[model samples]
Target: MNCQPWLKTLVYKCINIEHSCLLCSELAEQHYPLCVACEHELPWLDEHCLRCALPLPMAGLICAQCSRRPPAFDQVIAPWHYGFPLDTLISRFKHNGQWPLGRLMAEMLGLQLHHRYLDDLARPDLLLPVPLARRRLRERGFNQAGMLGRWLSKALAIECDEQLLLRTRETPAQQSLNAQARQRNLRRAFALASAASLKGSHVAVVDDVLTTGATAQAVAQLLREAGARRVDVYCLARTAKPGQA
Candidate 1:
């Protein structure tokens, strides 16, 4: 089946019109959503905990926190730190309803996956977004994580099962809580939707940001419980310090 000519034209126009970085409002020089300046200025967290992707004082395989209590996901891949133009872009995407920004974030994330996590980027068996609660979904009109998951799946040629993970409860935002409190709040907040599709699969969980990583950890734990062989995290940004969580 072919899309109607008028509809196709409309879609093309929508994608082409003077696209600019959401933060700088400068013309984007590349196909990706962010402008060149914004892209170059992205705060990359190179020295981080390999397991959690949290910024660390020195290069190491694991951070003290992850050592004390390991995260559910085996590994994390984040393209940038949660700050400045990247944070502004994320805020616009989540709070201001800028849907296209999700795709852009996914593109940058895909690049990171290719460069940093080369072994895993070949393609996961499935890509799942950390599910949002019904109330939050209603308020936001979209799940930013789900949107990114779809885009990432397409880019990576992996299947995206938007319904594989379910948020069992709506917890308060982790931004206002300490690490311990964040973990407690997110406990029991997620579950797998089905065991059939999950059994023996390697899944990649997508999220727009990783703060305390409580939400991702919960989701990954549930996926593993449901029989997923492995679960890795792919987030657009990671929080820099402790208080940010």
Candidate 2:
């Protein structure tokens, strides 16, 4: 046996490692930079639409609206509701470039998916980060979705392809538009880089938040047109449908 490994373990045990909570700076119990109390206080989605991850009154069922008009994506797996410190964290991470918070979110999301995978669900063959427009990318200095995808890809050992998906054109910000207008804004906004060999590949589009889900739906339709067998959406947080402005 290697004595080197034993020496390293001895040194590790000799050092007292302390993790502080991101929110309260209390001694954290979880590995994701958050204390048990803070983690429990987050707006966790207990019941949601299986298809969209929209907050619902009960669990383990699809919502009526989805049954009436199904979306292009087959399923969504979001770990939290888009509210409170999570929304604030995302905002700063996306706009102000607070990478630490974004990374923490990514770590937590990876843990959630890893635990959920015990069910032996159909895993995606490829992970694609929802593309940001060129203008937004230049302004923001980074694509937040892409960062999350990189983290998840490494964590789950899934292949992630950032170059294959293309945002062909820029559109109005989805947050500024209502559901119908949001759908219209994204029409013809995406295209595949190459339809080389993904005829029956299952792909999951990674994103930070699922708002109206117009973006995911549009991307799913685009992926289908590119011959993907199935497309799912994986988001860190999900927002409730906003009333039309």
Candidate 3:
């Protein structure tokens, strides 16, 4: 049967408005859906660790914490600090079902990945999200990391493997714990689903934020144990402080 024209028109309008530029509430002028002003205001990270992507003070190549005890991931890239409007944006994206922000964040991250890793990001064999535990996933009705990973994979033209990793244990929220407590809470919280798909693959792990780097470290360690050749983290935001847990 032929569709009704009026209904089709209404659907089209909804789609157009939904995809409109969030910055200006109009059609986007660039590949990313943000207007220039909003794009400029984003807290882009600069002078961060080449390995950890932690914001670094002047005259230091690596943060003292990473120098003292390095994480398992080969590198991390977080384009923004998790503060101010970025924090609000993440809250909306995670708790209020603001999916388009995920796309915008992923686009920005893809641009940063291009500028930072250059050719290496272009050639990653797979993309994996830091998995959410099944209970949390059910409660939240979605996994924010998985949403970010899918968007990133599309932007970077990489294969996104949603099942590559699994959160095998549920832990208390990291916000409530100190660094040592957070580390202890997250121990063995993640596990590889199976080595068959990930064997000898270079995987880029995606997440919305890197706070203490504990969760990402655990996931990377599991990936390596499952025979992943290399694992790098791609996050939308990172906490500003070194000792936050």
Candidate 4:
């Protein structure tokens, strides 16, 4: 039997152990690129909305926004709150092209999903990265969400189709807008490259963060309309509601 994969993993572990933790200068005690302490200190999401992953007072309840108008996506799986060094890492990876940082987060997210799948989270048939507008793609040099999807595809053995979704037009950044304005900004901003590929398929839309979730809703609606059986959102982090701590 081939031992290359095992050998590579062993070698990687040897090297990883010798490095320092990304968050702290401590030895990387964990098998990953972080020490146990640093990893534990990250802003892990605990109780959150069952539907949108929004931070809530308790677990297993849908947020008011989702209750008022249910999203097209069936569920959202995010592992962290958008805060602290986690947010800094994401911003650096997204804006400054710090790919290794992004990969580290994606690896962690993939591990979380793997455990969730063993429980009740339904494994999706297809991983679709929310496509970026052509102009933004050119300016950013790479699509961070696409990278996350591809990495997740490898880790979870899922089929990732980067070309399945297409951003037909550019919209203003969603960060500055509230949920309603964000929905308006994304109107007609996305399209599916091929509806046939999504027919009766369970799809997970991979993204970096779930803020207002306007983009996720828009894409999920389109996919559902095009015959997708179910669509879910997978992202690194979720932000709190407007007024909540």
Highest TM-score: give the candidate number: 4
lDDT of 3 at 88: 82
Per-residue lDDT tens digits for candidate 4, residues 52-96, read 999998988888988998999999999999989799999999999
| Model 4 vs. true fold: TM | 0.91
Candidate with best lDDT: 4
* Deviating ranges (above 4 Å) for candidate 4: 1-17
Q: Cα RMSD (Å) per model?
A: 6.0, 3.9, 5.5, 4.6
Off-target runs (Cα >4 Å) in candidate 2 are 1-17, 243-245
lDDT of 1 at 214: 82
Off by over 4 Å in 1: 1-27, 116-122, 243-245
Write the residue-wise lDDT of candidate 2 on 65-111 in tens digits: 78999999999999998889789989999999999888888888888
Worst lDDT run of 10 residues, candidate 3, spans 15-24
TM-score per candidate, in order?
A: 0.84, 0.91, 0.84, 0.91
lDDT of 3 by residue, 142-213 (tens): 999888888777877888888867777889988888778888998988776654566787888888889888
Per residue, candidate 1 scores C-alpha lDDT tens digits across 201-235 of 88888898988888888888888888878888889
**lDDT (0-100) at residue 24 of candidate 1?**
75
Candidate 3 residue pairs in clash (backbone atoms < 3 Å): none
Where model 3 places Cα greater than 4 Å from the true spot, the runs are: 1-20, 24-28, 116-122, 195-197, 242-245
Clashing pairs in 1: none
